[model samples]
Target: MSGAPAGRAVAWLPVARPLTLVPAPPPEAAAAALGTVWPALRRALAGDAPLAVLPAGAGPADAARAVLRPDRPLEPGTDLVVVTSGSTGGGKGVLLSAAALRASAAATLGRLGGPGSWLLALPTSAVGGLQVLVRSALADREPAVLDRGEPLAAALARLPAGDRRYTALVPTQLRRYLADEPDALASFDGIVVGGAATDPALLARARAAGVRLHTSYGMSETAGGCVYDGVPLDGVGVRVAEGVELTGPVLAHGYRLDPAATGEAFADGWFRTRDAGSLAADGTLTVHGRLDDVVISGGVNVAPQAVEAALREHPSVADAVVTGRPDPEWGQRVVAGVVPAPGAVPELAELRPWVAARLGAAAAPRELHLLDSVPTLHTGKPDRRAVARLHGGDQ
Candidate 1:
């Protein structure tokens, strides 16, 4: 076992075929160890597949024995598989290689001023969370994992005070931090917010509160976030084709066991993200929303993000999500789910005029629903489908 630190036990796990209960290590050390362990992992996974990665808190030895079995035919093209964020549909698995993983880690470190100790608030199973562990291992620092179930204040309190720390959060997390623990926001040198469209109001709030926040744009295929604050990071490249085409060091090799998806998403060494973005004259990129986020209302295309942005500018609106609900007259009509500022309830009719002045009458919501909280996925992104299902019709 590696004697680095109490949390750095991932390095010492035995190289057996069955599932391993290795402790999570720093990114750099973990990468180096993975170089050694991957060949064995591949070989073992080929036979009876005596390896299983026990979930957190499982007994290591027992977990190993339970999963070990005799040799079997290796599944062709099956390697490291990661699930994609199911924002649009059901989640799909993506395959990755050790080399691809390392290249992504290296590229990310190179771009983001090199890795330091990370404070992981996201789940490790998620691509964003997995990248944190990978980056920390590559940087030779043990990441401090925040309890997912803990309150934001309590979680922030657990992080050590003086180290240069990094953390990734979805926009909702940023909003919560800004609302609940303004002081804790300053603890990190940099904070990355992504996985959904961030409201202008939230960004303004964070900036006003003196939090260093960078809006990120990337997905699992790009090996986590390659773009930071609208600029492609070092070793990362961006292009606008049908949507946003991204390339460079952080790009993944391909999907696990699915050549067709690999071919469809990647073209000429670039990963084509279905997200729509435009580069401004000053060279900052502004992500509009997903290409599919556009809805036709009375034969006019209405971008929900455009409407949401306008609503967020209102002082009475604390948070807003704009989506389309089915309408017989207009195919799909614009609707807003809003969270009003504490003790201030703004009527839907009044909010519509406010949005119309900013985004034009076509962009105004036909109906508004006051919600205590908008439904969000585990990734902290708004669940548009759920919202649509809940209030798509009947107004």
Candidate 2:
């Protein structure tokens, strides 16, 4: 389980030394708590008293410690362990060495032009948020936490004007900002969006509003985003067969305390991603969706992402999530959970025809459930299982 870089000796730490598990403070306290966490995090990245950051909530802390086993010794070169449920909703500890984390940060800064100030808009518990800290630390600049209870404009104004400001956000957060404060969003030199796919329409809107948005791909296993704007970062490699596989200095060592899962995912020097994507001739990568998300509806392979993208473009639909459920006739039927546009009442009749025309009859959702908002996980991705439950009359 050693994550030691090639040619480096595996220097095992003493068993009595346990890595500290720091639970991120609530949003309001996060900015103040940074002073404490930053020092510890810097030490961890320097390979002294490595630690794991548990999520803000109580359940995540308990769950993380149960698996983290702080009293036990870690594999050689392992500096940080990030606990992620990822898109599958099952928790796993992702082991990342200091070298890997630093490489990801350096490559990201290189790709983005140069190092500068960063706004911490995402939660620290997640890899994306942690990367914000990592990049900020390496850049020798303190990050501004968005959780400081200030308006977006006020926060943006506080960032150093001399430096090229950057921030990371999920699509949901980006949408809200685009709707409420477009000017503030445009202040950043770069904005990296990841955790889930960003709708093309949304990207167009953001770009039109002068928002410099960079769509990112990768997960906690890659120490945050290894790919930005469909291009792999410096020194990172991307190959797509049945699923996306990544290899490079940025890849995580392996999962902590779970050799079986680790071996299955990281093998032959590549980490197999659950995403299904394709690499274009020009080297651009297009991620379709999760490999398991493809639905065989009416004997037709339907990609939920395509349907969801089409649904979002409709005038009456503000946001939408598509999933497949059991059906007697089709074996599996496509279902939609939609959030209607402002003051708009979206009906199944109009929506069905809209999707049918854009995609196809088989791709259209057979059932539509209108809601004020779609259910999402902590990472801001739509909770597909929860959406399925809602469609099944669970409310």
Highest TM-score model number: 2
Task: Tell me the whole-model lDDT of each prediction, alpha carbons only.
Answer: 0.66, 0.86
Candidate 2 wrongly placed segments (more than 4 Å): 1-16, 393-395
Taking the tens digit of each residue's C-alpha lDDT, what string does model 2 give over 1-395?
95879988887755544687777777777685477667778888888878788777787678878878876678667889888854555688899989999999999989888999998888787888889999999999988888745678877776898999999999988988999899999988999999888989899999999999999999989999999999999899999876999999999989888899999999999999988999999999999889887878899988888899899999998999988888889988898889999999898899989999988999988888888898876556788878877777221
TM-score of 2: 0.92
Model 1 whole-model lDDT (C-alpha atoms): 0.66
lDDT of residue 296 for candidate 2: 80
The digit string of per-residue lDDT tens for model 1 on 83-177 reads 55466775555544445556676766665566666777764445676677666766766566565445555655555666667788887678777
Return the TM-score for each candidate structure: 0.77, 0.92
Candidate 1's TM-score reads 0.77
User: How many clashes (backbone N, Cα, C below 3 Å) per candidate?
Assistant: 20, 0
